[model samples]
Structure formats: C-alpha cells, structure tokens
Target: MHIRRLAAGLGAAALLLLTAPAAGGAPAVDPVTLDGPGQITDQVGALGSRKPDVEDALRRLDTEHGVQLFVAYVRNFAGRGAQDWADATATKNGLGQNDVLLAVATRDRQYAVSAATDSGFTEDQIREVNATAIEPALRQNDWAGAAIGGADGLGAVLAGDPVPAPAITPGPANPGGDGGAEQFTASDVIIPVVAVGGAGAAALYLFSSRRRKRKDTGGGEPAGWGGDGGAPPVTPLPELDDRAKQLLVETDDAIRTSQEELGFAAAQFGEATAAPFDQAVTSAKEELTRAFRLRQQLDDAYPEDDATRRAMLEEIVHRCTEANKRLDAESASFDQLRQMVTKAPEVLANAEAAAARLPERITAAETALTAMTGEYAESAVTAIAGHPAEARDRLQFATQHLGEARTALDAGDGNTAAVHVRAAEGAVDQAETLAGAVLRREGELREAAAKTAAAIRDTQADLADARGMVTGTRQDESTADLRGRIGRAESVLAEVGREVAAGRYDPLSVLRRVEEADAGLEEALTGAREREDGERRASALLDQALLTARSEVDAARDFITTHRGGIGTRARTRLHEAERHLDQAESLGATDPATALQHAQRADQLGEEARRLAEDDVSGYGGFGGPVPMGGGLNTGMLGGLILGGMLGGGGRRGGGFGGGFGGGFNPGSFGGAGTTGRMGGGGRF
Candidate 1:
C-alpha cells in the first residue's frame, strides 16, 4: 500500500512540474515576459510578502525617470546558469534601452541584475548598490527585503541620488538547532525524492545508517556540522626533506647577497646620513632571523608522519618566499636611497642659489613692466604686466617652501627634505618663466617700435625727394589726385607720431598704420615720378619692390617647411594664405606692376608672421616668451584684468570619478562590480 501511494505522488508531481530541458534540447518553459510596469513575478513564491513593495518601487522609477525595472524568482535554473538565463530572458522579452532586469534563482542560490546598454548606471555603482543594499537581506533569508531594497537602491542610483542604507534584522547565532538532525521543508524533500523514485529512497536510507553509526560510537558528525563534535585527525606537516633543505640554502644565499648590497649602499651614501637605508637594513635583518628560525623548526621536526612532514615543508616554503620578497624590496629601496643621498648636496646648493637670486629677478621684471607701460599704453603692455606680478607671487611661494626644506634638512629628515626641495624647484621654474615672458615682450616692443619709426622716416624722405623732382611740372587730374593722397599720408604719419609720444597706441597697430602710410606715399611718389620720367622709372621702382617681396616670401616659405612638424594649425593656415597671395602677385606683375608689388608685399608680411609662429611653437614656450604683440591699454587695473583673463582663458574642463581606499588591508579594483555584456554595470558575490 505504501509503495502504491509513493508511485501515485510521483506521477502527480511529474505531471504538474517538469524539469528544465537538458543541454541541446528545447526549453521546458516558455520565456518570461514583463507585462506591466510594476509586475514582480515569483515563480517559486520566494518573495512572498515583499512583492507589493518591490512593485511600488518599480512603478515609481518608471513613472519618474522612464527606467523600466523587472524582478523574478524561480526555484531552479534547470541546467542553465543564472547569468545565461537572465540574458536569454531579457532578449526574449525585447528589453529596451535603460531597462533593468533582476532575476533570482532561489534554489540555485544565485541572482543576476542585467541592464540595457544605455542605462546610466556604471559597473562600480551597481556593484556598490548590490553589496550595500541587497546582499545583507539575502544573507538572513529575507527574500522580500532583498527585492524591495535592491529595487529602491537601483532606482536611486539611476536617478543620480544617494542610495539609502539597508535595514538588517538580527538573528540567532545559529538558525539550525544543536540536535544535529538535517532540516528540510516538504517541498524541498518531496520534489527531489519523487523525481528519482527508489534511487532517492536508497540514498536517504544510507544517510540514516551513517547517522546511527555515528550516534552509537559517541562520535558527533564533523566539526563543521554546527555541533560540539570531535575534530578529524589532523595530518602532521612533513619534516624538511631534500627539497626543503635546498630551498633553505638558496634563501641563505639570497639573504647574504642582500646584506652585502645594503652594506655597500650605506658606506657609499653615509649610513649616518641615510635614514631609509638604515631602516631597511634593520628590517631585512629581522626578516632573515625569522626565516632562519622557521628553517630550524622544520629541520628539528624530523621522523614525523607524511602529512606532518608535508605541512612543515609548506611552512618552510612560505617563509622562504616571503623572505625573498622582502629582500628584493629592501634592495630596491636602498638603491634609491643611495641615489638620493649622493645628489642631496648639489640639489641643496642649486635651490639656495636660485632663492637668493629671486629678489633681483623680480625687481628686474618689475622695471621692465614699468618701462613697457610708460612707453606704450596698449594691451600688450597690460598683458606683459601680468607676468611680472605672477613671477613675484611665485617667488614668494618658492621662498616659503625653500625655508621649509632647509629646516627639514637640518632636522635630518632627508626624505621629507627632498620632497620640499622638489616643490621649491618647481615653483622657481614657474617664476622664471613668468619673469622671462615679461622681459622678452618688453624687448620685442622696443625693437618693433624703433623699426616701424625708422621705416616711416625713410619713406617720408623718399617722398620728399620725388616731390622735389616734380615741383613746378605740368600737372594733370591724376597728378592732382596723387598730390592730395600724399598730403593725407603725411597727416596720418603725424597722428601716429603723436599717439606713440603719448604712449597711447599699440606697437603692432602703429606699425601697421605707419606701413600703410608709407605705401601710400610711395604710390603717390611713383605716380609723380612716372609723369616726370616716363613708365621706365616707374617700372624700375616696381621691379625693385617685387624683388624684395619675392626674396622675403621665399625665406618665409623655407622656414615654414623646415619647421612644418612643429607649426600649429593657425600658422599653417597663414602660410597657405601667403601662398595664395603670392600666386595673385605673380598673375598681375606684367599688367599692373604697382598693384602686383602691393600684393607681393602683403604676401611677404603674411609669410613672416607664419615663420614667427612656427619658431614660437618649436621653442616650447607657445609664444609665452616670444615676440607676439599684446595690444590693450595699460593701467593698475589693466594688470589685474590681464592676470584674471589669462587665468580664465587658459582654464579647461577636467573629468574624474570616485574611488575607494584600503580599510582592513590593501584592496585594488576589488570593490567594483563585474562588467556585464551590453550594460554599464557589474555584480559581486553576496
């Protein structure tokens, strides 16, 4: 009668529930589908009381942020792993971008949270949420808590908000009582027992027989069975065999070599002066002692059981490995210490010398800035003012750091002193750069102003000579226009001289305007000469101008091509423009000699600008200490304005993310979640 009842139960269970298909077979159940926004399906009824809360969280997330969330619980995954099952389920359901699926294999004791590709959650963030919010609840068998907490945490992360801490329930030390009977629910035992028929029954009978035998012998099951039971016989580690002896010999040789190197480093660098080297030597000595003691222990514990001998050998091997690692680290540290010690005196001297010269350099830079501002009230003088101010500030900073470094050196803290010295040196370099830029700019302005003035004077003299030759000659309408233009050019030249004397003009702009006036005077003079001496003289002047322009253009082109790799995009563009202007000049040289000369001159100027730009790039200063003209008016406010503008204009956007540091011990890349396919997220074990 009992056998018949068992057969009936098996038949009924088989008809109601089928196992998942074997590998290479069709799936036993249809793929899961997410039918609603807040649906939480519990195939195994694991999330018994928590389904409503989980559903509410999912609905809220979807409504607020358009992030879809799905949760599921199943008894088993058949033969499919949790990761594979979750991926297949998500694909079959046509999960859209930013959709997230959390699947739990209750019987398999595994879970996976799969996210769509466009989800904002990063792998690190997802891992943190799971470890902090969901895993704690799962550990205490609170399935409902896991689902609700996980949903809320994920929702918070997706919304760019902080996740709330998980609420944990305290449980007894041991949930299973001390009676030692294996606990099983009806569903857990009956389903598996019925699936395999009498074979399952025979396994249960054998387990019962083993328990009876253990009870009769007064021997509790094993130590890990949650009962006060006798431990199984421990295998004694083996004594030092030939292999162990050989390792010990090698370890001793390594220790001796390390000691020799340490001694040499100490002698060369002065042991009394090298604190790190002394400390490392002490540590290496202590580690060697420990290694020797471990070897001796293994050697003395002879004639032991095979297990005991093996254990002893393993301990010796561990000690030797650790000792070797320590020796290597010590050796490298001592080598660095030696280099630092040898260079300390020279570095200190150089830093002291630089500090001493800071005041003179600062004063010189200030004088240059003052002179620049007095001579030119343009933006270039204002821009140049900022460099001196920055230099002064950096010098002060360097002084402070240098003082600290000296104090540290006096206190015999070489390592700390070295750090301060390096900082001081960096500050000094920046100060020098700033001051140098000011000095260089002032020199360039003076040179450019003088050259432009000279050009204006020479062209004015030439025009006067031409005007004398045409004095009292027969004048036509064209000659009348030429005379009027010459008068205009002279007026502009006087105005430029007045602005320069008042220190209210930009050097480059003044240069440009002066050059324009010179060109106009030359053209007017040329027209007058042509009327006096015919087209032959006019052609001669045009030919001379064109030759000069061609020579300058050729030089500029050669310079640009030679430094092509170092030139920037702006300079390259200017060079191409120069080429275009040159081509135009060539096309018009025969038809309009005067116009062709102007075009060629313009091309020459552009080529010179391009060459200067390329040279600045090659020098690594990016025109910082180069002759590029800055053109704004100068005043006390201008200095501050220039400095502020430079700071803001040079600033660029920076990107970064949060990172965790060591707590109990060293941890690297261990806190983040595992990255999943098609998702910006990761997972971790509970």
Candidate 2:
C-alpha cells in the first residue's frame, strides 16, 4: 500500500471517530436498541434456522481474524444514511476498531456496512466485500448468506487469497428494450410434480377480504404483487398494468412452484443436482423482491415524483422480465434432471455409465497429481492438491447414490428413485470435472511459469530504471522510499530467480508478486506519460464515452432491477442521474465528443456509484421481506393472484415470514396444484 493510501485510511478512521454518535433524524421507524457489544440483533428475524450458521461463521471470523461483526435489522435508519446509522449503532454499543456493523433498515429497503478505524480494511476493500460477496446474496434476500459472505470475503482479504469475483454488472439501462421474452404457456416444470387436488388447493387458501383489502393500497384497483410491497400504477396503461400484475402473479407463483420442486429434488437427488435450479429460483425470488419493493413504494401514500414513479414501474416490469427469464433458462435442465420419476430404469442406467467412467477418471487424476508433485513445489500445486481426493470422494458419493436409486426403483418409489439417480449423475459429473482439473492445471502451471519468468525479467528492467532515478537530488524523501522499493523488488526478483532456476515454484504466486512489485515501482517513480486516450480526437472520445456511459448505466440498472428489495432511493436516484448524463452525452452525438466525454464520464461515475450504493444497501439489509403467510390465512391477492410476499402491514412488521405471517404459513404444498396449469386460477403466468 502507498503512504498516501495509508493516510487516507487513518483519516477515514478519525472522521468516523469524530462522528460516532450520529445525530437523530426523522426516522420513519425507530432504530432497534442494542443491549451490548457484538450483538447479532435480529429485530427483523432475517436469519431464521440459519442463525446458528451465521453465528458460527461470524464467531470464526472474530475468533480467527480478530474482527467482530455485529448485525442489526430494524424498521428504518431513523431517517439517516445507512452508514451513519450503522456507525452510531456501533459507537452506541461501545464497539471499537476491528468491529463492523451490518445495519439494515427493513421497511426502507436500505442497509450499510460500517467499521471502526482499525478494522484492517480500507474503504475500498469494505465496499469491495459488500459488492462482490455480500450484496449478491443480500439482494436475493438471503440475509444469512449476506452476513456469511461478509465474514468470508473479509477473511479472504486478510488471508491474501483471491477474493470472490465482483458481482455481475446490472442489466443495461434500457436492458436492450427487454430481451426476447419467451412466452411460457406450458405447465411450469418441476420434476415429479406433486399432484394437488383443486378443491384441496383452494381449501389451503382462505383469501380474507379484509387481509387482502389492507395491503391492496390500490383499493382493489389492481396492484402488482399484492403484499406490503404491492403498489398500483401511477397512471394505468391497461396492457402494461395488466401485464405487470399478471407477471407478478405468474412469477411469484412460478417461484413458489419451483421452490417446492427444488425441495423435492433436493430430498431425492441431493442438493448437487438441483444447484442450478436453486440459483434460478433464488434469482427469481430476488427479482420479485425488487419488483414488490418498488410496488410497495408506489403504493405508499407519499407524494409522488412522476418520473421516479414511472421509472419504478419500468423497473418493476424489467424485474419481472428478468425473473421469468432466469426460470425459463433453467427449465430444460431442471426438467431433464427430474426424469428419474418416470424413467427410473433409464436414468439409473445413465448414472451407471457415468459411474463406470468416474473410477477411471479418478485414477487418472490421482496419477496426475502424483506426477505433478514430483516436478513442482507444494505451492505450485496447492490449488489442485485436493483434486484427486475430492474426485475419489465424489465417486464414492455417486456410487452410493446409484445404489440408492436402484433400491428406490425396487421399492416402486419413482420420485425417490429419480432423486437418487439425479444425485448420482450430478456427483459423477462433478467427479469428472474435478478429475480433469488436475490435468488441466498441470499444463496451465507450466505455461504460466514460462510467462511469469518473462514478466519477471521485464519487471527487473523497470526496477533498474527506478533505481537509476533514485540517485538524483530531485528524489528528496521519495528517493529514500525509492531505495526501499528497489530493495523489495530486488529481493522478489532474487527469489523468483531461484524458483526459475529450480523450476519448482508456484507460478501464479510468482506472477502476482512480480506484478505487485512492478506496480509499487511505478507508484514510487516520478511522472509517467499522460494516458494515450487523452490524445484521441473529440469524436473518437465521445463515441467511446457514449459506449462506456451506456455500459455503466446498464450495469447499474441490472443491479437495481434484481436487488431492488435491499436498495434505497439514493441508488435509484443515482442511476437516474447517470441515465440523464448518458442521454446528454448521446445527444451530443459526434459534434461534441470532448463535451460529450465529460457528460459520459459523469454518467460512468454516477452509474458505478449507484451500484456501490445499491451494494451497500444489500450488505446492510438484514430483513427478508418475502412474506411467508402465517396463521389467520393468506391474503395473497395483490389484486387477484396469490400473494407470495406475506408482508402485508409495513413499517413495524419486519419479522413477517420467519417469526410469523398474517395468516398461518401459506404452505407450498397447499399451492401444489400451482405446480402445473391443473389448478390455481387459469394458465396466466405459471
């Protein structure tokens, strides 16, 4: 790290210290009062059965990394920024450096990740963790996952391992005028679909007119996804409005149906075979969450900004579009995996074929690992060290599942049979991939070593240039720093030389070390030439700028589209600003690339900022607003369809799903006929 970067880090700490006791604001909801330090205050009950998992993970983070993670879910941030509110909460709880607070405002759809000064993370790193690990999970309303991801990502930074990949960029601003949406008229596919009687399915849902009456802020004028988050259109466009509501119902119904199928699949085939489907469902749920949240905001009696409201509706439509797309994409794979229910013999036979090949693959992998170990250092092969063992384990797992499938076939339990066969197939396939990785890695490492050696030489030359510059009086204090940098680079080069000589070191590590050392030398050295792009013509720059601005805006839009449940107004506002700037830049066309570039740059900055703000909200949110109807019966009709978001009453009721719902839990089993077009109103969305 550079000296300037360190000072910035320290300054950040001081600022937080000075502002620890955040002042009160016009909070829409009261902040939860914490009793003490390191509290996992689940005021909103986000971490249901997974509380233990989060506790264990967080405990491990603190126990092993000397960092404390405190979490709180509240109604809203007391009318303050999520970060400020989090800081105040941490300070009020008497927390110090090495302490981080993940604060979430349930009703506000906002969150923040705040840490004390000495938490061993720069603001950038904090934001990175939030964006890469935490937000993706949080946006899905996987509250526990968000918390766990935070702990894992922070730990990875400390451990000097590669951090998780950055979250995917949000969909493009206009989302390419919506991708070619595949109309789904066929029964939504779930393997071994449970047959639910229509009357029984209807019996399960007691749509209390009163319960339905309350969440319907449209006063029964037709809302999107009826819930606490349901909202009516600002001005109805009959087709769009109908589509939005119908889509919400269909999407929600699809998610419910998919979840049921997933559970059954997981039970029979194990989680491995159903992993992809899980991701799709999870993604759809998050999208619906965003759609519902937007709907909720629209429904709120607050005075409206027409543009903002229109944007929200547009966003809702986009969200619904994406949710259905995800489900549709995975349908084929999901349906195929469920074939064991009807074709148990054939499925089992396929697994046996995979099972036979796996053993041979495992042996080859073991041989490859052994051969590589003799030629490379331990670090060089550390990545693939477990490949052989893992493959062997999966082979055994597959074999066991195969046996189970056969037994289920004998017992005439087709569903169970299908599950085991799918599990076997999945395990075998994974075993093959694991086995193959060993061979692939060996070649990759060999080539990387060669490339890395060349890079090392190039870096050595750069170090020498830096050393040459260190002798001048112009160096001043920087000269001393230059000497230190040269010394470090020299040491790295010498070590790499020895490794190259031995031909037995971690090539990846060597490459990274050399690169970092090179970067350090650059930072210490004086001036470099201006960026070449600056020399480009205004037209050229403007064209490039327009493209860049569009990309950033698109990404921000995609992120907001999916993760709307946890994001707040600032993110949406930021994205809107980005869009305006983008439009301005595009309006310039070729006439003013230079001027357009400026607007484009602003758009890019705001677009990224919008994403950052959204990530912050996701990381901070601890509430799972997906309503799980409890006793009293589900009033799931946003306008007419079943309400998936059991969240009816807003503001105070953050613990709707896990703690309890308006009605008793709306059993997915009760909605079983919903698995197909067999029941649950007509064939609209499902």
Candidate 3:
C-alpha cells in the first residue's frame, strides 16, 4: 500500500500538494467536533478505551510538548489519493503549525501523516515516525497500537529523546528458515521476460515511424519529417489543435461571465458567502492564463522541439479542461445563491423575525450578565464584559438594514431588498451570537469550575497511573520523561488547587493549565464510530483494482481463445495490449503500487475493448454462415486457461469490466465551520 501523503502537519493543516492540484476534490465529509486541544476521529470504530488513552497522549503532546496531533480514521481514502484526502481534511479543519494529522484509512490499508511546511517535525522525522511507530502496527492490523505508537514516537521527538528505529525486520523469506527467497516455478520466471520482450518489440514497431521523426536523425535534417517538422500524431482527435483554441476562447468568456455574475451575487450575499465562487473563478482564470502563455510560446518565432510543441498543445487543452471543470463544480451553487434575489420577501420575513427577537434577547443577556457581576469578581466576567455592548451595536446595524429593506421593497427592487435582507440577517445573527455568548458563558464557567475540580482528581489519578506503569523504579532513561511529567504535574496541581480556592480565576484557563501540568489521562470526546467492529484492515483497494483488471483480462483472453477463428486482428491486438499491460503491472507491483495501479487500469480498459471486438467478430461470423456445431473434445489447456463465455449473447464478460478513477468525480462539500482556523499547506504521494 503505497500511500500518498498530505500535510496539515496544522491550523495551515492539510491539503493535496500538487503542481496541478490533482483534479480530485474531497468527499462531503460531515464535520467532526474537535473540542480537545488534541484529538483523534476514529471513524472506523473498534478503538474502545484505547481511543481516549491515545487522545490523552496527543493532548500531552500538545500541552506539554507544544505540538498538536489531529488524527482521523476514515473507512477509506475513497475519491482521492491518501495525501490529497488527508491534506484536504487538515486544511478544512484549519490546523496550524505545530499541528500534525495522522490519517488512517485502514479499510484501504493505507496511512498518511501530514504537517504544515513550518511544523515542528521535519520530513525525515515524519518518515522515521511512520516507519518505526505507525506502519508496523498497521501492517500487524493493530489500530490502537498504531495510534499509541504515533503518540509515543512524536512525544519522544518533542522531548529530545531518540525517535524509535524502524520496527519492520524482514521475516524469513520462505518460512523454512533457510533465508532463501520464496519458491516459484520456471514458468513464473519465464513468462514476464517473454511478455516484456514481446510488448517492447510490438510498441517499438508501432511507434517506430513517430520515434524516428521525433529527434534529429543521423541525417542533419531528420527522417520521416512531415514537411514543417510536424508533431507525430499522438491523439486520435486530429482536430485537437482547433479544439484547444476554441476551448480557450470559450473558457475565457465563461470566466468573464463569472466575474460579472460574481459582482451581482456579492451584493446580495456579502463577500464571505461569495468567497468560494470568487476563488473558483480566480483559479479558473489563472489556468486559462497559463494555457494562453503555452499557446503564445507554441507560436513563437524560436525553433521549438516537435515534442515540446505537441506537449504544449496537449497541455493547452488540459489546462482549459481543468479550468472548465473548476468552474463547472461551482456553477450550480453560484446560480442557486443568485436565485435568492427572487426570494427577497421570504428573506425579509426571516430577517424581520430575527430583528423582533433582539429586544428581549438583549435584555435577558444584560440581566444575566449583571447577576453574575455581583457574585463573581470582575476578572471572572471579563470575557463577556463587552458582549452586551456588541449585541447592542449589532442590533442598531440590523435595524438600519431592516429600514433599507422596506425602502427597497417600496421601490420594487427585489435585488436591493435581498441585499438589505442579507445584511440585516447577518447583523441579527451576530447580535444573537453575542447575546448567546454571554448567557452561555455563565453556564460554561460554572461547568468549567466543576470540571476544574474533576481535573484535579483526574491529575492525581493520572500520576498514580504514571507511577503504576513503572516497576522497581530506578527512573532509567526509558521512564525519565514520565517521571519528569509526574513530578511536574504534582508540583503544578498543588499550586493550582491552592489558587483556585483562594481567589477568582478563569476556570477554562485553569483546566488548560492542569492538562499541561498533568501526565496523560482520558480524552472526553466520544467518537462517532462509522462501522461496528469492522475488519482489522480494509480490503486493499489497489488489490481490488488489480483483481478486477485480471478478471477482465482473463475473460477477454478466454473468449478470444474459444473463438480464435472468427476473432479478427482488432480484438487480438487489443487483447495483446491488455496482456502486456497486465504483465507490466505484475512486474512493477512490488515496488510501485501507484504506477502498478495505472497499468492495471490500462489493462482493464484494453481488455474490455478486446472482449467487445471478439463478441462482434463472433456475432458477425454467425450472419455469414450457419453456426458450426461446437467441437466436443478440443484440448484448450495449452491455449492458457480458456473458459466457456458469452453464450452467443452478452453475458459473463459483459457484466464484468474495470474502468479508470475517471475525470475527477470529486464533488467537494462546503468547507468552513466552527474551530476551523486553518492555513496549512498541501500533500503528495509518500
């Protein structure tokens, strides 16, 4: 499982680090509630008690060591590379420097650790941590151990302790303990060599003319040049050059249209609501600009390489294609937001309802604020001191907008009324948040004070647990960090307890201090387990990809072998290419799963084509002559695993086909939410 890595590695936390922003976008992931300073989202379940232990360790990592670890366990990577998915999650979460994300898509049997470019851990350190702590436990199907190991490993690095060494000692090769490689038959060794040689020879033959025309041949001019040293035909669409130019112009017009639409929409739905659409249009324009630059370079006076021009031309189309895709992804949402202009009356009603609630809400908020002021010290109420004033200002703003809305409605301008309604709604919501904040603050403080008392007890228990893990303690190097932690917790909690009882303090602040002061303990977040006791590892997605490819290839080969007499060159040729690609995949599988996946996918595509061609050839043969009675005892063993298929109608092979990841079927969900103050960088294959 070769995983592509992503970096949140924090609040700038993760996203796919790609030169071209891999066309895939993240899935519509419902937001996870990140309450703790450090945490893990165990979406695959099965962690039980270990989830908290691991989270406590992560909290310790952050509180004590100044590093945050954001962990996620998804069912699978699904629509994007591990790195891309990981990065997107991190970025969406808005994790910052000193924060790192440990994303485990165990169902896919792949993991990626992402950190910001400026994170405390280096690339080399991340690699070390994964090898020594993460992957070994993963390979053993120990999810809890993997998570704990990550915490333990990162903790060691932060404490300036030696990071653990690689834990994967290669096992006895054949289980015979002779230290030799696993046994394979002579044919196993022979087939790939013959396949590679055959494929290479065929490709060389088919591409020879283009290859010869590619560079300056032995002759000073060049062999096989198409007059003005034209690019050798690469794409099947000969009109691609014309198509590229047309797409570029069309996309540019689309971008301009978007900009104009954005202007109109921004007035109704403020800049914040319109920001994503603006970003999409900007990104699309940048891509279009790059395409134009490529086009300009292509038509320049300088002598260009034939391959370079062809590549640039293809790239022009690709750039335009990507630009169009980005725009397309946002079009519906953009259009819907704009359509809100027609819903002005509805919007105004809602805004008016919000305004009506302000008077009682503000009075309740101020009354609540005043009652607390007398009982608690001013320091205790500092957080909400301005909450009432802020609520008042927002109410004033809302009233102003509400008046504008009525005026716009009188003028029969729905768009203007919609704009006023949006502003009034925002102002009212802010006033509500401000009022709610003061009311909620009272409950939060009382809750925090109670929690502070509990935290003290927890700290004491944590110390006992710390001591319990130790035996006949001479406090060796291994236990030194824990020992130091216990000593520090004991000293800090003593002072904290005395101060908390003596005078008023921010209970939330005290809790954070206690968390930092204490040794590791339980995390409070109850994760939403996506699967009830799922498997140790997800069925390997890449393995499934390969299996499907092989099925398609085998089906095609069997059908062709059964009807070789009727099958023409097209079907046989496609089948040969499929076999060749499959062979290449097998050869490369051990070293490169990413590229192996690509070849396997190609094999699947070609095999499908071959099966269709073979079916057509067999069916057309029936029209030419009466069906020959099936031969009874033809030994098909030497023909390489032939099977009875397609009973003269579309059957077995038709039901089974494999296809590509396909033109980035990424429908990205909305990105902003609570606790998501992110600025992290991107990700890639690890």
User: Which tens-of-lDDT digit does each residue in 57-158 have in candidate 2?
Assistant: 789887666566777766567677676677656545544334577876654557788763323455667777777777776556666777788788777876
Sliding window of 10 residues with minimal summed lDDT for model 2: 677-686
Q: Whose lDDT is greatest here?
A: 2
lDDT of 3 at 310: 69
- Highest-scoring model, TM-score: 2
How would you encode candidate 3's per-residue C-alpha lDDT over 528-563 as one tens digit per residue?
112321111111223434554665576566455434
In model 2, which regions exceed 4 Å deviation?
A: 1-337, 407-413, 477-480, 523-686
Candidate 2 local accuracy as lDDT?
A: 0.57
The TM-score, computed over Cα atoms with residue i paired to residue i, of candidate 3 is: 0.30
Clashes of each: 19, 21, 29
Preferred candidate (lDDT higher): 1 or 2: 2
Question: What's each prediction's TM-score?
Answer: 0.30, 0.34, 0.30
Q: How many clashing residue pairs, candidate 3?
A: 29
Candidate 1 regions exceeding 4 Å error are 1-342, 378-380, 408-416, 440-453, 464-491, 500-509, 516-686
